[model samples]
Target chain A: MKQRLRPILWLLLREYLEHRRLWALAIGLGLAIIALDLALSLGGQAPAGGLHVMYHSTRALESVSGNRTGTHMIGSLAALGGYDLLLNTIAVLFALTLAVALFSYGLACLYDERRDRSLLFWKSLPISDAQCVAAKAITGLAVLPLVYAVTGLTTVWAAWAINIGLPMTAGPTPPMTAARLVGFSALVLGVLPVYAISLTPGLGWLMLCSAAVRRHPAIIALGMPLLCALLNVFGLPNPIWHWVAAPLVPAGVGHALQSIEAGQAPATALAWVYQPMSQPDPWGGVILGLAFLAAATYCRRRHAVLA
Target chain B: MSESDIVIRARGVSQRFAGRPALTEIDLAVPAHRVVGLIGPNGAGKTTLINRLLGLLVGPGTIRVLGLDPARERHALMQQICFIADVATLPRWLRVAEAIRLMVRLHPGFSAAVCETLLANTDIPRRAHIGQLSKGMVAQLHLVLVLAVDARLLVLDEPTLGLDLLNRRRFYDRLLEHGRSGQRTLLITTHDVAEIEPILTDVIFLDRGRKVLDSSMDALAERFVEVVVPPAVLTEARTLEPCAERCVRDGYALIFDRSRGRDLSAIERLATARNHPTLADLFVAFRTQSNA
Candidate 1:
């Protein structure tokens, strides 16, 4: 097993190195969004009166919700409603950026090698086609999201720090502690695995399209759903359309946003978001993902690179 | 030769694209430790055959390289087989050092020390991406990487395409120096047949998806003869049924298949001299005859 896995591990590592620039681009874009947010807030464009009202409301809620560590972090975030909005906006932007990157990366991962005629070189190696496709799938599904999550969390921490330096809006400031920061980091990090798990089938489908199509994989990837929807209009049930489209909007992001809107603690929200893992739906999705992955591997092996 | 001496064997192999056959019922065997040249014109299925041998494409037939089925056991087959399809096959985004590093990590047969020594003599820098290098440099880099692998069979399809004459010579010289150690086998395809003819121990002629000729260099020498016939006895030479005929400055040059038991003495009496045909002459003669 060690010998079998060594080349596959190397192939995955190669994928990471080859596409590392895209991850850097995602992180850089996230940082630029944060910088833009800071510029706007510091330039007096922020609504200070509304922020003060929200801060008072948050303090009242914190007093009634019991003085716990999670409540303290929530109260700190609520004290600066503008910072809270910026943090959420940054998170949303990072998520959107990651989705776009993965979409493009997954669709192009197999096609680009053929377009550049490098598929011949890659095929010359001893590694099997299945291993090659698996590496790309892992890169797009797991590694990219992990990098985006880390970058997004770092931006959140930076926003929190910046908010702390601003003048308070009348009440006593919440104490900033290392433990609270660690808790927040954990909360953000917790969503990544959930996101990766939920989005695997969708990413795997894109890779399959990339490997199977002769040209313009994006058109085919987008058109297939529309075609399925058209079939639905003609009275056919389109479970495939639902399966493909549902995961496009990541379940973890939706759960996180819903928890935030409900005013739940970050730890509680994270736990709720991950609760689906124990259920049958996500496991079914995993099996479907493995199936798509196997299909992609089969396509990679049989499809001629330059044909 | 024993069955163990065959590194590549294809029996009744056929491949079709959209109902048109690219290769048709082709049978071939490449013995170990011989430099075999796959010579053919455009669209003659040389690349298709090579791709089949490398397990790059799946088609109708059985192909085994190094005792492993290419289609079903390509991963195992690849461990002992190294190939360079062309100069443009290397990824353009990969840096020189990264390419080497990847090879070392992925290929257990790769020798970083040998690769480093080879690259040290070239102008390619460690930091330079493949796209940043010249065509010759890219070919050089590819050659360095491929030669560093201690594989048993090396297949090259137009490996020196677009290279200058000097670089092409150097490339082949290096290939012959390092790849022909009596433990390694080479199967190469190129349009420049004259340049490779000297080093080819065996030659296979492919045309229109058919294997027209498969012969060792010595067998080819004994089977085909090119005779310089005087115009006075051109009719007598024609009775011997030369495969091809062309007018030259001296007189008429006639290519004959001596393997058919044709009377070479008649041609010798009617001709100025008889000599062995070069691979180019044989290729043209066979192809022209087949086309006719």
Candidate 2:
């Protein structure tokens, strides 16, 4: 197993080296997002309904909970809802940064090789086309996200630090302890797999286009999914539309947002948000992803370079 | 020769692209311990044939390299097969050190020491991206890549396609310095045949998708004789059925196929000078005559 894994691991590293700049861009973009947020908050009037209300409301809840007042219950639920909104929404933005890296990597790896005719050099190695595809899949899907997640969480910490440094508001500001940061890390670890696994089928489709298409692969890569999404916009309501955005939006959040908009309580929304992760693993979706990757690998071998 | 000695065996190999034939009816057997040059003009299917042998391509006939099927068992074949396909095949974004590291991890036979030594002679820095290097440096790097591997077969297709004479010579010198070891077989194709000629033990001439000539260097020298026949003995040389004739200062330089058991004594006596044709001369003769 060690022998078998050595080449696979090396190929994965190759993928990372090939697309390392994209990871840097993702991290940079994540930091830039926080910087932009900092810029807006530092000079301008603080938004009342944003982080301030949540910080103060949380502190008020902790104080009133000593007396078990109805106000404490409402305030606690409100604070939990605010945390959910702030973290999950920012999480989506952070995930987008990683997803962009993942999408570009999947949509370009084989295509660039074939375009540059470097697939011949890669093929010269003892690695098989299947091994090559698997490494790209595992790297772009699994490993890149991990790296992107770290950078993203670091940017989050930076943003959190900035928020903590702000002058005291009129309301009591709840503090973020080390434990809260750890909790945020746990939240990232939990939702990331759901994102990666669900993202696979779309990524596989993108890679298949990379291998098979002759020109303008981006048109096909984004077009089919965009069409499905547009159909949903037109009230076609195809579940296929969901697959288009499946990898982009972390699972359960979309379902919970829809449920909450339909009058579900904010406190009960965690049930909807965690529902996807709490269920049995979506092995079938993963299998479908593998099937797409298998097709992409076939296309690569069939037309890797000119005869 | 024993079957084990034959490094490449192809029988009735043919390939076509979009119904246009790229290679046709090519039969070749290159034995171990020999440096075989696949010489051909542009569009003569040299790269196509090499691609088939490396299993980057599968055509309409049988091809076996190192006693393994190239298309079906390419992963296994690649362990023993090293190839420098062309100038553009190496990834441009790859840093020199990353390439070395990847090779060390991928190929068990890859020697970091050999790679370091090869790099030591060149100006290519460890952190330099391949695209950042000059064309000459790229060729040298390519040589470093293949030569560092301990493989039974080394195939080079236009390894030095568009380099100046100095770089080409440097590449060949480096290739010769590290490429040859024990019973390793080499199959190479290049328009720069003269540079590779001294190292080639056998030569295969390909033209218009067909195998035109397959002979060892010794046999080629013995088979194709070039003689300067004066006007007086030009008629006499015709009896030898020279394949091609070119004008010189005083006589016609006639290329003859003396392998056909003909009496060349008459021409040898009549001609002022007689010698074996160079690989380039022979190649030009074959190409021009076939076109004619």
Candidate 3:
């Protein structure tokens, strides 16, 4: 198994280097978000000093029940709170970029498989179709998410540092916000798996397109998912058909939006504007992955012959 | 050698494409350590047969490579065999070195040293992308990869279709060197039989999907002789034996059967001497038999 993986890894590494544009896109998006955050930070006014009252309101019993804590309690409260806006924005941008990167990667996986002739190289090896597809899926699930998360963290840290070092205090925000930064970083890491799962359906479509299209694969590469979406939308009126179409949609969109508006207190205005859908299970993503493997195998079995 | 010495055995093998038969009832036994050339004109099912042998197709046929049924266990069977078809395309973006590395890493039997040596002979740069190389270079690279693999059976279908004369000669030289070891078996299909005739031990002539003739080179030469008889003796030769007559500018040429030791003494007693036909002439004579 280890021996067989050496070639796959080598090929993938070479591919990554060749398509340096992808990594550049990731870093570019990261920089853009940081700039946007800096712009917002600079625009806001100095915050009203409401920490004493807010701390007292949330923790009335702390002073009476514990060792007479006053200024320290307020500081801890400020350190622990009011960073939901940053987290929510970062999450949305992270998920969006991650989804785009994954879809593009998926399309490129099969497109480049034919274009690069690596499909033949891999098939010619002792590896089976399942192993080949699995390697691709693992790269999709594991490698891609880590890249997005790391880039997102770097972007956030860069933005936070710029905001603080510029001494731009926005509407009573944390004077020393390092704790909040740590908290958001941890949260983004936790949701990385969910982002990976959200992209599996797109990956499956990409795999099918890879197998079906020999020439100008990009047409099917872009068209298939849109076609499926159009079919599901048209099928929505029929009760029987809606049930069939229900499972295809990923839950991450709704969860991410809900987490955005539902932060600290549910913002009714924002929630009503964008009614995010319900969360789907991780196992659903696995089934989509299996479908990708099956499609890859079919493509390999029938038309995978290359020079 | 025992019957087991036959590395590839096919019986009642037939293949079809879109309801039309390409090859029918092909029974061929490829023995160990010999170069067998399959010759035919266009659309003669040579590629189809090679595909079936390499376990690259599935139809109503039974093919066994190294005693393993290709239909049921293609991967296992192909582990000991390598195939290079002339028309097949490889990924173009990979560098020559990258492509070689991929092949070596995957197939356990592939020899990296041989691949490097073969590339060293050609103008293929290690870092040059495959898409940038010419068609002849592609053919050379594919041949390099196929030759690098240490397989028991090597199936090459028109392996040098795109090579220039020099590269073609170099390819043959490499093939000769490889076959000189006398351990590997090769099945080559090409239109240029004369180019391959010197190295080939056996030839199988296919016409419209049927095996017209399968014979050893020496035996085929000794058995089938194209004798030129004068106009008067032509009738006598035709009478003495059921010879197929092809009109020539100078005289009536008759392809007489010499395998059964048929007497051509009477014709020779009357007309000009015989001229032994080259293998290409024999192939042309057999391939055009129905039309003639």
Candidate 4:
């Protein structure tokens, strides 16, 4: 088992080395966005009206709250709500960037090698073609997303630190705690597996097109579904569009983020992440994705770079 | 070579592209410890046959290299086979050291120390990308990488294409010096047949997807004789049925099949001079006869 796995692990390492620049770009862009956000929020003062509203809301809550328990609950909820809004917005942006990067990367992973005639050299090695395709799939589905998640977690922490230092309001600082950081980390981590599972079909399709198409794989990958949608005008069912959009829509990710922000128990948030797996649509998507993966392997085995 | 000595065996191996046959019923056997040359013109399926042997293409017959089915057990077959398809097969973006490292990691037969020593003889830097190097340097680097492997069979298709005469000479010299150790087999295909003829132990001529000739070098020398006949006796030499004839400065240079039981002493008496035919001469004769 060790001997069989060693070469596969090396193939994966080769993939990472070949495309590490994409990871750098993703991480660098994430940091730049965080830095720019910090510069803007810290360099500028809160508008007078916004500060006035915060002060008035705090005073109103304090005066009406004769019950300590009620006031504390309201304060905690407000704090949690504020953190959720800020963190979820950052998560959404990061997720969007990652989606674009990973989509483009996956589409080009197999295609570029053939285009450049490098596939011949790679095929000359002892590793099987299935192993080669699997390495690319893992790079796109797992490795790239993990890079984004780590960077996203770091950006979230940096933003939280910046918020603590910057005076966002004239009133007392909103309740802040390390638990907010833990919750944000948990949320990103939980959402990533769901995102990976849901996107498997789409990722597999991209790789399959990359392996099968001789020219303009990206256009084919995007245009085929568009053509399918156009065919729907004649009353044909548009399952292709649905398969392409099922993971890209990110409804499950949003739901998990919202649940975590609502101060739901961690177990409940995690359950929301796994909820998509139990759905009929996602199950179908998984089957279709697996079929695509198998096709991709076949195409890769038949592919010749110089031909 | 005996059957047990055969490392590559193909029976009725045929390939086609879109109903156009590239190779038709190719039956071949490659014995170990021999330098075999697969000589052919363009479109004769030299690369196609090599691809089949490497298990890169699956076609209409059975092929076994080192007792493993190329189609079903490519990973295992590749462990003992190394191929240099062309100079451009190496990725242009890979640095020299990275290429070596990748091979060392994936190929248990790869010897990094041998690769380093070979590269040290060239000007290729460890940090230089393949695209940054000259064509000759790329070929050299490729040769270095392949030679570092302790594979049993090495297949090269146009391995020295586009190289200068000096680099090509040095490439083949180093290849012969290191790659062939009496236990390793080499199957090479190239258009420069004259240059490669001296090292070939056996030659196979392929034309239009058909094997025109397959003979060991020693048998080739004994089977065919090139005789320069005087114009006075040209008619007598014609009776021997030479495979090909051409007018030279001295006389009519004819290539005759001595294995036809013709009296060579009689032919020698009629000839001004007689000698063995070169591989190039045999190739031309075979191609001309096939065309006719």
Candidate 5:
């Protein structure tokens, strides 16, 4: 396995070289979230990345301090799950940003080489089309997420530390401990693979379109789903907006926020992150995603000739 | 030679685009350890056949390269074959060093040292993106990449199409040296028949999607003769059934295709001069005959 992975690892590095703009967008969104957090902390505002949990906790802390006080506000904040909320907020924001970036990368990855006629050069190498497609898929769905996770975690963790060290007046300032910080980091890092897996449907669909279309892959990637949704809206019976239900789940974050606001459950990163995915089993969508990838690979192998 | 000794063998290969035929019933074999040139005009399907040979396109025939089905075993076949396609096909954003590094990592047969040595003779920079280079430089870079690979077969498609004269000669010199290893077979397609004629051991002529001629250089030399017949014997040479005749500055230059043992001695005795036709002359004659 190690022997086989060495070449694939290099191929992924090649993919990384080609897709830095997507890298920047994912990491940059994480940074922007950090900036938002800092601004909230400095401007004496409330946390909004995950707003309700942290806000209510802040309000409760202020009220308690006003009525009677000890150094237990930090304990109360942790009890209210403010830290986990903060972490989950970054997760949702990172997932969303990565999704947008993946959309652009997946659609362009296979098409641009064909357009530029660089496919000839790439095809000259000993690598197969399957290897080529695998490299791109891994980069967009798996590797990019891994790299950006570093940036995402650093942004949130750094912001968390800064807010506490600088004494934020309103946001959650849970008492920091090395164990707690390590535990929080573990939750976010642990979800990386599953996070990448949940991304397959959109990324795989875009990739298939990118390989199959001779021009304007984005239109097919975006338009086909829109066409379905529009058709659903006009005349579909018994189901309203059914086409909009499980579409790569860009609405996932919205669902998470709504669920949390409704007090159904704590917004564990796993729960909300998997919210847009089909419950009891998201593997069905995953299989569909893999099928799209397989089709993309077939298109690449079949249509390597210069147009 | 046996089937294993053949580097490329295509039998009854045919391809069509939309309703128009691009290649028709083409049969050619390039044996191992020889340089073969596929010489034709721009629309003569040279690129189409090259594409088929490399598995870039699939059609209604069998093409065996290194004894492997090019389409089914492309991954394994690619390990043994390398091609220098048209200029600027390398992505513009790729740095020369990056290309070298990538080939080294991806191709087990690629030698970065050999590639770098080839580049050292040129003014191309390792740090410069391919897009930043001139057309000639890009062609040189492409050649360097292909030449550095230790493969069983090397295919070049108009590899020097836009190169300057000096660089063109330099690239061919390197290609010739690479072919001299005696282990690699070369199959090249180009419109510059005159330039590649000296290096080709075998030549195939294609016109209007059909194989007009295919022969080894030795056979071609023995079978075809060019004569600058004087006005006195022009009619006599015509009786020899010359394949193509064109008026020269002084009289008429005629090309004769003769069967071995039948002899071109008649034309030799009647014409003012006779010699083996150059590949370029043969290409033109064959194309003219096919057109007629």
Candidate 6:
């Protein structure tokens, strides 16, 4: 297994070295954003009095915003930006972009093998097809996340430093609440599966497309979804049409039209998107992601077209 | 060779591309510890045949490598079989050393020492990025990677295609030195047949997606003949032998598979036989024969 992992590690290292420039950009931009946000808050306005006004007046604003205790702002500014909406927005978009970057990195990882024709080099090795495919999946699922997490933590600290150094009454204090830290950590962890879920389907499709069509994979990548959309536009009664339309239609609206005959209260919309993670299975996405990875590996091994 | 001595036995192998036949009813046997050269022009199904043996393609028949079906036992087959296409490709971001290390790590039988030795005398800096290297250096790196594996069968598809004359000669020399141990088998496909003829033990000519001829180099050298005749005698020479006649400035040349002993008395009466038909001449004869 160690022997099988060497090439994967080599590829990972190669990517890291190639995109080292991105690291500089990420840290530099992160620090710049941190400094600018801190400076804006410090320069925004000032308190009318000293410590009494600082503590009591801050509480007044907190109660008005519907939080009896406004510890949310400390973690918010330290971790995410100021507003709760902004926090969630940044959290989601950050996760989304991270996933996209990972997906693109995965694509380019395989792309290098094809463009350089070094895929033959990997194929020629004694490693099994599963090992090769697994290496790719592992890099995507494990290594990329590890790098992102490390970079994320580093940037968080830089943000903390910038906020603390600036002259602000509500600057980051030393004793952070354990609940806040734990809550924010849980939220960040919660976003992981979102990244995984977003990535798996696209990767699964790419794997199948790459194996089935040896040439012009990019064409298939862009064309397959567009073709499905066209089928929907043409009134093709495909399963994908229902899957898409089911999410778009409000159940109340559709039910009200049907209920004119029966005349009852409009039916409640069963929101598929709002399925709570605390429900039946929280790890469903994780399991599905793994299943997709397995399918991809199996397809890669059995299909001779990739050769 | 003994039955156990055969490394690759391909029987009734057929391959198609988009429902068009690339190879049909192909039968081939490659013995262990011998250098077998696959000679052909472009699109002669050489790559198709190699791909089949590597289990990269499957069709109507079976191919056995190392006594195991390559498709069913790719892991076992790959452990003993190393393949290199003539085109040079390695990750551009990798240093030459890193590529070697990766190969060493992945291939169970890879020899890091051999790879190190192969690059010892060359200017292939271990730390240099593969993209920065010249084409010949990249080819050299690929060869080093393949040769380090303790494989019984080494399949090289036109492994010197883009190499300059010096690098090409060096490649042949290094490859011959590696094969001199007489412990490994090599199957090579190349348009440059003459360049490889000196080291090849056996040769197979693939023309128009079919195997036209397969024989030992010595047997071929003894059988095929090229006759040189005065230019005016060329027309009469054509009727005497089922051969390809070409007009040289000073004299005319005719290449024929004289192993069948086609009547050549009329041509003998007019002209004398040249030294021998080289592999190139045999290639030309096969192409012309297939076309005819």
Candidate 4 residues lying further than 4 Å off, grouped into runs, are: A34-90, A162-177, B229-236, B247-249, B266-273
Model 5 chain B: weakest 10-residue lDDT segment is B258-267
Candidate 5 lDDT tens digits, B90-205? 98878888888888999999988888888888899889988899888888789888888899899988888877788788778877766557488888888777788889898888
- Tens-digit lDDT string for candidate 4 (B98-182): 9998999999899999999888888888998888998888888988998998999999999998899998998898888887864
lDDT of each structure? Answer: 0.80, 0.78, 0.67, 0.80, 0.76, 0.64
TM-score of each: 0.88, 0.86, 0.75, 0.88, 0.83, 0.76
Instruction: Write one digit per residue (lDDT tens) for candidate 6, span B174-249.
Output: 8887754536899999877878989999999987678999888888877877788897787787766645767765
TM-score of chain A, model number 3: 0.63
Residue pairs with clashing backbones, model 5: none
Tell me the lDDT of candidate 1. Answer: 0.80
Model 1 CAPRI rating: medium
For candidate 5, the per-residue lDDT at B172 reads 84
Give the winner by DockQ: 2
Give the range where candidate 2 chain A is weakest over 10 consecutive residues by summed lDDT.
A168-177
- lDDT measured at residue A183 in model 4 versus the true structure, 0 to 100: 72
Per-candidate clash tally: 0, 0, 6, 0, 0, 0
| Residues A129-150, model 1: lDDT tens digits | 7778877877877788888888
Task: Give per-residue CA lDDT, model 3, range A118-211, as digits (tens).
Answer: 4554454455665566666667766777887888788767755755566444335553356545645655565555545555655666666766
Q: What is the lDDT of residue A90 in candidate 3?
A: 59
**Predicted complexes: DockQ each:** 0.62, 0.68, 0.17, 0.51, 0.59, 0.40
In angstroms, how far off is B267's CA in candidate 6?
Answer: 6.5
True contacts kept of each: 0.80, 0.86, 0.21, 0.68, 0.77, 0.66
Evaluate residue B8 in candidate 3 and report its C-alpha lDDT on the 0 to 100 scale.
Answer: 81
